[model samples]
Target: MLQHQDHLALRLALIANKRATVVRLRDERRIDDTVLRRLQATLDSEEVRLSGGAAVE
Candidate 1:
């Protein structure tokens, strides 16, 4: 269970990093609004799952 919790934390951190990178890319015009929205939604969903106490795969 502790390992599972650690995995979840790591997943959250990775998702957050990816989200930040996407935002930076979008700001620099490397990615469009559509991609940004999609990425944001994915990140939000993962966050919801973690916050809801769902186990990480």
Candidate 2:
């Protein structure tokens, strides 16, 4: 449905934003292992959501 697509799009956008933040932090040498792990966990969860074909919201 259109609403589901919109939700997917929003989730994708959020993932992109988080990825960019991670990149920015890495570039600035401000990302610690704990932060990296957290981000990785979040990305993994998002990946699962996408793979499961579930709506984000």
Per-model CA lDDT versus the true structure: 0.88, 0.78
Off by over 4 Å in 1: 53-57
Error of 2 at 48 (Å): 1.7
Q: After superposition, how far is residue 22 of candidate 1 from its true place, in Å?
A: 0.4
Top candidate when judged by TM-score against the true structure: 1
**Pairs with backbone N, CA or C atoms under 3 Å apart (clashes), candidate 1:** none
RMSD of 1: 4.2
List ranges where model 2 is wrong by over 4 Å. Answer: 53-57
- Lowest-lDDT window of 10 residues in candidate 1? 48-57
Candidate 1: tens digits of C-alpha lDDT, residues 10-33? 988998899899999999999999
